[model samples]
Target: MTPNTARRNEASRRAVLTAAFDLLQEVDYAKLSIEGIAARAGVGKQTIYRWWPSKGAVLFDAFLMLSEGAGGEPPMLPDTGDLEADLVLVLRATVDELNDPRFEPPMRALSTEIAHDPELAAAYAERLDGPLREAKRQRLRSAQQAGQLAQGLDLEVAVDMIWGPVLNRWLQRTGPLTTEYTDLVVTTALNGLRPRGSSS
Candidate 1:
């Protein structure tokens, strides 16, 4: 496509995605449809089909774009050289984001839909979880190199240890997310999982 055409296509795609997101905030994901998205975006229905196969894919992409921001890069995880501080920083930001009703609903809806739809779940795992897991692995590797983590730590397991408790709490609404909560997670993970000889 010509540069002008490419730019127009990009603009149209963004318009549709934005409309989908707005509709998600306004209506249930189960009630959302391509027709509504097209109407809201002022784009033809064919324009959406030309790019995405289903509303699930469109909503998935829209959520991904919204979560990742309009920019291409994933949101940064902090790396302040103090692993405990860095983890707390990022996780607290996560807590804030999860607690925000706007961010939480779309995520919850998508997660619920994925649970019932095996194909959607696989696509989500491939498109979202896979990249996030790799990013967490890199963060854990950096901590390991800094002598902050136990030698031969399983990076994937380590990521789970850090994320699992917080995610459970968020999903269950079982506890408040506070500085105290974050401190406990960081301290517990380090002390329980890291080598005894390792220093904070």
Candidate 2:
């Protein structure tokens, strides 16, 4: 493709993503349609179909884009050699992101839709959960190698335990999502993972 063509394509893609994200905040997922997205994006319906198969697919990509940090940096789990500190940092950031106005509504919409749609849930897991889980798994592995975590520990379970409380609270709206809560969760989880007889 020529340089100008590539730029135009990129611009169109960005416009579509932005429109989908904004529309999610304005309309319920059940009410959000591909035609609406195309209209809001100032592109034809065929343009959206040329890129994604369905509105769910478009919304999924938009969610992933928003999760990317400012300037489009990929979402990351920090590894600072201190497992507890790293987990705390990551979870605290998660709490903030969950509370952010731009993310909260879209995420709530996606969560609601995913609860009833297996295919969309699978897509969300593949596109968003996969990377986040892998990042946490890698961090746990590093901790194990450094003797910070107990040997033979199930890293997957460890990742879930660390995140379970925070997610539960977010979804249930049962409690405030504070940094202090995240710090406590991280500390409790790390305490369990630490080598036997080692005090955290």
Best by lDDT: 2
Runs of candidate 1 exceeding 4 Å displacement? 1-8, 67-70, 73-76, 193-200
TM-score for all models, in order of appearance: 0.79, 0.80
lDDT per residue for candidate 1 within 97-198, as digits (tens), equals 887877777777777778788998998888787777777778779889989788989988999998899888877789987767977897788789646665
- Between which residue pairs do clashes occur in model 1? none
How much lDDT does candidate 1 score? 0.82
The alpha-carbon deviation from the true structure for residue 155 of candidate 2, after best TM-score superposition, in angstroms, is 0.3
Candidate 2 per-residue lDDT, tens place, 1-200, comes to: 99999999878888899998998778877798888999999989998999998777787778777767345554567788888888888888899989998888778877877887899899888878888788789889988999988898999898889998899899889999999999999887876654756453
Quote the positional error of residue 104 for candidate 1 in Å: 1.6
